[model samples]
Target chain A: MRWKLIIDPVGRPGRDNMGLDSALLRSVQEGGPGSGGDAFLRLYRWDPSCLSFGRNEPATSRYDVEKIRALGLDTVRRPTGGRAVWHDAELTYAVAAPCHAFGSLRQTYLAIHQMLAGAFERLGVTTTLASRRSGRAPRPSAGACFALSAGGEIVVDDRKLVGSAQVRIGKAFLQHGSVLLENGQDVVSGVTMGTIPRVCATSLGEVLGRSIAFEEVARAIALEVRERWSGSWSEESRSPETIESDKFGDVSWTWRR
Target chain B: MSNIPDELRYTEEHEYVRSESDGVVTIGITDYAQGELGDIVYVDLPDVGTEVAKMDVFGTIEAVKAVSELFSPLTGEVVDINTALDGNPSLINQHPYEDGWMIKLRVQNLATIEELMSATDYAQHIGE
Candidate 1:
């Protein structure tokens, strides 16, 4: 099989969510059992809502740390790079596998986005992939991830719909992103420090003209996954070799940049 | 086709190593790597005096599409990093071999560099 499906529908804390994704990425990198054939598509949600920073995003200097705490928002830094994303009321998906599973880094990114676009289509929501910008792009220094869409990102009504990021290590890589079920990214702009750009974003409910649930979105994605890859999807537990992540939950790691 | 300079040696991970002196060698991603990564937005490298093992991640390069680890090709201590990338990471997309050079290391074993892929070997490695 080219893919394995791990649907963790229950919400968990930000640290543990990021930790599982990081550990799964390492499992695919090291190459042993339970690594999934070519990829592991783990779909999950966040508990109590969380704000995640890109691995290198300057959160300590730009984000209102005190405000985030006071708001009771769980936070963690993703191993992948992009910008800050408010992971709330969303269906987050992580794909971890060998780099060659898709192809070159750029190809891998676009291919995954294509799968996501197809999934959205099954849910009757049409999406277009953003083109690569000619000049500058959104930097990791500040601003919300949904504030702008990079080339190859997924969009609807010309607003950013799915914000994704990737990180490559040796022979393997991990790419993950959020498919917002509700309009939650607005919270990001409120917490940023400087006068950052407002979020140009959309959500499944907004596009579908109704409220959307995580299960409906997950079903559409799972159907797309089945059609895209050969063989049946397996529901496997976490790989035993995956290391426990102390850093994902650590403040030092989150605020390291 | 991406240029593979004849004088440089390369790791399978796509990092190029250029001999700077007796024990010092400069490291950076190959033209092929920058091409694969697309427009670079930022570069994060280790500080001077940081020791790294061969194949260990010393830093990461963030492109518009992805962020990839920069693996150490030769085990050594960091001597310097390209601070120029702090402001204009596009230097990598513009001239990855020259202005985009990432790090300098005082190699623990100079002879190991000889084991790295030559330009001809790298061309084949990338299926050029």
Candidate 2:
């Protein structure tokens, strides 16, 4: 349950952020368990409001790319799998570790969200996981992540507040996603090609009836991880890997699916 | 419990190798892997004729919760792939050993198949 904590005080571009996360996953994959550390947790935000697609998400045909570019939004495909998420007015968290450290994929997803729900409760906001009982899995046509809650997403009264995706490389894995502090789902809805498109998500600020800063939510989440796992947190920083950014910038990589 | 057919060989990573001829073998994820991965959504396999190194990642399997890498069990060339998986990946969950088979590799050395785990050893490897 030991982990490293990274908080990026200033917002960075989407490519740089994605690059660092991808690089961390590769490092953990190549280094194996207990090389640099067992796990890493990075809380960051995007500059100029980027829109990210999942690793294998059908973005080429499903998204309105011309409109996205015209609206002046940065775009990149995530190393993880899921759907689209608009990376603005939200706190993004990236975690990379050996696959066994988090157990299986579903177990890891559930465990992380459960901790997040606990974190939100500490911040005076109640959260629940959207499961089969809570809602239906999003139809294939659901383009934006927040448009529908998948089984393990964190939701507040049926509105998704956090959307995360995970990818495994050999023995290591990286899971990263957005925790909205403000409702930015509308922008995602507008850039998609779904016929009856609309964003069905809420934000921490909306739930708490007041705006919140990234630091406030970050502190609560960090405290939750420490208290629940009986773990210590070592601080880290983002250092871009050129190979990762170069791959991200390549058009073929973005439309790789 | 997960199925581990006695006729097939296995890798620690959960890929199963089934011989079809002197120099060719079929490959797929074991039933235990499909069970652990849950509902399958997509599979990305290398194109036919692609040379794959032993233990190298040859593709990825995207289940509902995450994307997992698929490693080659033997050094070979991809002779065939399951095109049906492109349209319906859940076949892996419903029938992991039969119709869900992922690829057919033309092995460089047929004897290498014996180096993999037998069903008994695989059963123990998974701590069954």
Winner by DockQ: 1
lDDT of 2 at B49: 97
Q: Over the stretch A1-257, how does candidate 1's per-residue lDDT look in tens digits?
A: 46778888478888888888888888888776766444689999999698999888889888889999898888899888888999888999999988877788878888889999999999899999987777755567748888877788899877998989898887889999998889888788888888877789999999999998998998898889788766557765443345445888889999997
lDDT of 2 by residue, B47-116 (tens): 9999999998999987766889999999999999999988878888889899999999999988899999
- C-alpha TM-score for every candidate: 0.92, 0.91
Clashing pairs for model 1 are: none
Best by lDDT: 1
Local accuracy of candidate 1 as per-residue lDDT tens digits, B1-128: 99999999998899999999769999999999988888788898999999999998998889865888889999999999999999888888898899999999999999999999999999999999
Runs in model 1 deviating more than 4 A are A36-38, A236-245
Mind giving the per-residue lDDT tens digits that candidate 2 earns over A34-129?
446557788899996888888778887888879987998888888777778888899998888888876777788887888888889999999888
Off by over 4 Å in 2: A32-35, A132-142, A237-243
Task: List fnat, each candidate.
Answer: 0.67, 0.51
* CA error at residue A152 for candidate 2, angstroms: 2.6
Candidate DockQ values, in order, are 0.67, 0.48
